[model samples]
Target chain A: MKQEHIQQIGAAVAAVAEKNRINHFYFVACGGSQAFMMPAQYLFDREIETPASIYSSNEFVHRVPKALGQDSVVITCSHSGNTPETVKATEFAREKGATTIALSNVEDSPLWKAAEYPIHYDWGKEADASDLNKGVLYYLIFSVLHAVSPREKYRKGMEAVAGLNDAIEKVKTQYAGIVKEWGKQYKREKLIYTMGSGANYGEAYSFAICLLMEMQWIHSNAIHSGEYFHGPFEVTDYDVPFIMIKGIGATRPLDERAYDFCRKYSEKLMVVDEMEFDMTGIDDQVREYFAPLLAGAVLRSLADEFAYQRGHDLSVRRYMWRMEY
Target chain B: MKQEHIQQIGAAVAAVAEKNRINHFYFVACGGSQAFMMPAQYLFDREIETPASIYSSNEFVHRVPKALGQDSVVITCSHSGNTPETVKATEFAREKGATTIALSNVEDSPLWKAAEYPIHYDWGKEADASDLNKGVLYYLIFSVLHAVSPREKYRKGMEAVAGLNDAIEKVKTQYAGIVKEWGKQYKREKLIYTMGSGANYGEAYSFAICLLMEMQWIHSNAIHSGEYFHGPFEVTDYDVPFIMIKGIGATRPLDERAYDFCRKYSEKLMVVDEMEFDMTGIDDQVREYFAPLLAGAVLRSLADEFAYQRGHDLSVRRYMWRMEY
Candidate 1:
């Protein structure tokens, strides 16, 4: 089942990119889909001139643009493919003269039919969809665009993602231990602050949702590491748990400064990086591009097992999409 | 001093919009700027087929696309106009072949000269620049655009803002009491949640900053009220102080629902709105367009007094752009 869930990394991405050749390239996704697109959007912008706008489907459908051309590709991503906003956005995109693409885990889900081309990424209930490795799905969507655009740097991006499977294997056991430890200590946390920079900001939001929204049932804030100094630093008290996502990326310096600043006011700080951990399985110094996905993968284990160990079923929380009005 | 600060509403907006008749618009604002632009961007896009792209100014100068011959207009709005990003964004826009228009309170400041036209309507220090009544600044920026295009709807928008000012006055003092009550009760609270919809989401960030960074020196989280159901509800215990920015416009239904939801988890639920308070001295609400600005004004008073009563000094907690990095 695990092997079945773990996709052929390159082929999955290449397929998505291949299909993207004809569409207008606008995206409506929520949670992980939106999270993963942060890095991919920049990658597409840096390489090809494809301009993809990512919005929460809930917000998009209510305010659908009238100007989308018939040729526009309105791609929607939802792990469950059952999220109301994603389903509505896909439909709305279709209504507004655009072709819809649904990238989801479930086949024949509502979003699947909403899209002109449904790319079923049958991952099953294996791991957190918001995890950056799963973010590979979003990257794969862009990978489809890159294949047709034919750029060297874009191809290099594909090569970078190719190492994901091997990287996953190398870090699995080590992260399992970390997850076990975190699960043990999860309940004692009063407040959690998740910080990331550049591409990692999306992962920070994912962490906020997965742990705070999914696992520990806690309230957490995701602040860009650069903005930490702007105002968020004042709230850093010794008891607060500050989870800093430090990767060897463009945001390394900012993350370092934030970590250092936290040390002054916070004693309970968890740093997630190769340098901070005992890297028994994973290679030391993963490329910055892949670190976000790796960090997300590592965090999934921490949030899931931690919540489970505390006798909390993910669904027991009974998430309600009920409107207040 | 208070009287000198009250600039005529319509003229202020018209002057700034007139000053910034350029091609592309880059808005440099933090909290309030983000709120106003959330809907304003849609207005600009729908009206002229031009989409307004926002950057935190510092981020824009470094990462935005090349700007030569773009014939751009950079409008930087700050309650105080002392924000570092706004200052830097204005200078950066000027360097890259863009005309700068600064809408700020201070008459002679860095941002004033940074722009081709600086519409200075100095609201005294006591009137929080972050407030919507200070719409004098934001209005000027938006109105300038309205004048250039001469849209009947926008002109009607000005009429609507003028009409709302009286409604705003009827609720001012009541909210002051809400702030006082919240501040007193906040001593026992561990965390504060700032919730809003659409433009209110942007304002929520400022509210969090006010409490977390300025006021009680407590940890706070800003969330879209609509998004609370997907997660965050599990963490909504009695220890949380939920602050809701109640909108009276397009998102009124969502805002009202958000307020009701907070009542369940929040030990103290404070709703900042015109209906909830007696707005006697206030007179700036002319259109529904300025609803965010009005809501912000009430929040500013609450945030300011809350911080002062808690013995927190803004000078010490507030971020300085130069020292941030």
Candidate 2:
């Protein structure tokens, strides 16, 4: 979150990009952490004209792409700084002579020690971890990409990066009441369907899996809106619980179609549209690129409210820390 | 299933490989068909040393990769032969001067007419359309990859292609009884969890979304075994229903880890292990490559039995073909 941290990440990335002729970037992590990296991956692929891939740590270790080499960079994150799969994948990427960057909350953990460049941010459990992680990732990813291809768009985005904290705070404040109400209403739902498309799809996936399923022990499925009608639509009866995160982008129509269909069939439909939130400092032209980050802040409020209404602590787990896998 | 069909597909793929200097491949489709293309995409990335990407048709149309151009090839499939998304994607790919290949059930369908090369197959709805489509894909994909970089391993695999029908039949016969029992036992369960890793992951995804959810109107979630522990595992309890597909591959241990954990917590766990079914004619060394296709045949039997036990016809859909989206 510091200006110095962004400069450090930029310097590290620039050196690697110059030495290795890096053209491909991979963001590797497990579970919710992996989802946090997706918006940056989407930005790199769309805005920077570089190939950016987001991979689950376990899968990346098994099916390491042949395209990865000295000319590639692998960025990994773990809040505890010691997720096994992520540490293993970081090690594997280093073994393949690729540059490895680690983002962790602890400075002395295994993931931090494994990477050539470690971006350590010490944040408390009470803070929204996903929003903090994304804040760092936006700077880390765009810096490296901007260094590779200097453009007016990248420069404009870079100028706006300084105001992201303000923008995120604005989103949280504006959407707090609605988030609390929706979470309270849906707290007892046995099963829920969450839908999104494009960059916001990762946020939708994380909200269902990490927040609802893992934190609250509720059954949830995150369906890509584009693929929703293909099969998942069969479950859309009048009483089905549906939560949709609508973003403004090229994939907006895809989510809109699903939203329209759900309105007709399901009575219990909750939507969090990006257009509803005011990203105060961000320019309208560049708002679509930052939709996921804005949405992540707003969704975290819902997760907190859901935890409160459901009488479940988000940190409590049945098996994750209770026993060894 | 015929030797001549294999040869014809190989010849067509080889010609495209030669003409375009193709180094990138995109498998584009929607829903079950998108899942069908995954194994071929996996094989192309693993064996061919080329960049292979799989995209849902709508996503592909919106975010057509900057890397896609004259040096790229787009392969799509539609069982109904008139999926609007696939037809649009094929047209988009062709506009970008990329070679487009379409596999469809009907010769006169729009999808068939949109492709530069259309591989038409006439198959009844009673047959497992997924298996039939995959059989053609294995030949089409591997042949193009082999032409790009010839190897004895590929040639040996090519020779074994002719015997796939016999291998698939053996799988169906071997697993028939168990499949029927599982269908009968789990017919009343409202929600099911399905997990798979490596190449067979797509089959697990297709089984949950296409067969269980779409056809039977049952609720199911297909979690990647490597990712099962990340969040989905929290939903597991004594009464939870789980159907795990255990495949033999580098990612086998990941599935085994989940299977071991699930057995300890859940009372209801049904496993369809690739090791159980004897792929008679397929060589042991190459067995992992064919795990998905083999698993597909075995799972189709479960879908059939579930339909019978639940007294719901697979073809009866409330919305798919009944209304306009």
Candidate 3:
């Protein structure tokens, strides 16, 4: 997380935008990293007229979109920079004549080698890698998109990115006590359901899968608020545990409906509304678009609290990094 | 599930193809029905050169793709034919001048009224609704794709669809005992992890969310086999129950990697390989394409066993249809 890294990514994005009439932007990565880039994808969808997609690395390799070509740009990430599927996908994008960009902590890794442009940033083990990457991606993606569509809103949004660190700090301080209490109360729960809509969907999903299930070994399922009414709502009971991330957006009504119902039915309902956070200096009109980032920052603190309360090390894993899958 | 129904769907698909030159095909639905159409989406991706996309109903409404237009065909499904989102989406597609097709068990439902071509079938309440919808969707999707692409493989595949009932029956009979044993063994477990890749991913996801989690009130998380190694694999332990569906396809290697890793780490690994079932009369080249349907047929029996073992009626629910959200 350095200013030089941000400048480097901005330069690379501008170069790609100048060189090609980009028809598509694809964000490809493995689980946590892919989830990390989802906010960028949502930004592209909501702000830029150009089409953008987020794909799991393995799926992208198997079904390379027909739209991918010389006019396309593919952004991929791997913190270790040697994740096999991501490296392979970056290579494939290059082979297809699409401009490939790689983001990673390791500069000498295979993913870095495969990219036309590699943005290397060293966020130490203590730092939240996803948050740092999200900051970088917002600058990179919005800059490229702004180059294409030339929107004033895009310029304003980029300016707001500089204040994100301060905004996240305020959010963490405000939610620390509540998060800790939640961690202690739900530490022994066997399973929990998480829900979010629009941009916040990715944060809800990654928090459930990566942090809760993967890091803590606690069972959790993330349900899209829009789809919750269809089937997942049937699982709700007076004692069922539920975590909802309410964000400000066009899809806020969808989340609201779920919240209203859960509050009546489930006694163990926890809602982390982005509106509760003070995102100072960010425009109210564009505040909803930043919900994913804000929610991610707050959820990291909750994950930490859960680790502390449950006496489990977040980095301790039985399989990941310990063995070859 | 009937030959006349297949012929009727084929005729409707041909009519749609004849009326408009479809540049894109979009399959949209909610929950289990959305899962039912994934195989069709896969078929369109693998066979036809035209772009195809699968989307959750709510997401499709929020971000209607720029590619959707007079030349686009949108297919949606809802078993009750009253799913508010799907009905609303079909109306939106019609307003956008895209050809809308609806599949449902209720012929007079709002979804049916909104569709340009409504394909309704009365699969009895006792029958597996998803399996029946899969059978109908296969004919509708392949016929439309074949009309555009004119591939001999598609013709041969259509011919094999005639024998699906027998193929499914064989799979059900073979897996019944094993499914029952699994139900009994894992019935007491608080949470289960399910994994599948390629075409079988939908079945794995739907079985976990729509069946185990929703209908039976059990906790389950479906992990894409390719994504399992990315982060979810960290949760693996000696007692963590896992259900892996191994399908035959280009992505089989992804599942194999996960299966190999889980075998070494977790004691509770249950793999349901499609190769174990006899898909009689299906051509070797097309058998892999039918993995989703085959997996769905087998998993239906497993869901039934779980319902019986848990002493929970499949129709029982705390919310969904029990109370308005």
TM-score of each: 0.80, 0.96, 0.93
After aligning candidate 3 to the native by TM-score, how far in Å is the CA of B247 from where it should be? 0.7
Q: How high a TM-score does candidate 1 get?
A: 0.80
lDDT of 2 by residue, A91-184 (tens): 9999988889999878779998898888866475554332366656766666676677776666656556667777777888888888888887
- Report DockQ per prediction, comma-separated: 0.29, 0.67, 0.49
Clashing residue pairs in candidate 3 (N, C-alpha, C atoms within 3 angstroms):
none
Model 3 iRMS? 2.3
Residues A29-102, model 3: lDDT tens digits: 99888988877777676665466778889878886576777988899999999999999999999999998999
**What is the C-alpha local distance difference test score of candidate 2?**
0.81
Worst 10 residues of 3 chain B by lDDT: B122-131
Give the whole-model CA lDDT for all candidates, comma-separated: 0.60, 0.81, 0.80
Interface RMSD of 2: 1.5
TM-score of chain B of 1: 0.76
| RMSD of candidates 1 onward, in order | 5.5, 2.2, 2.7
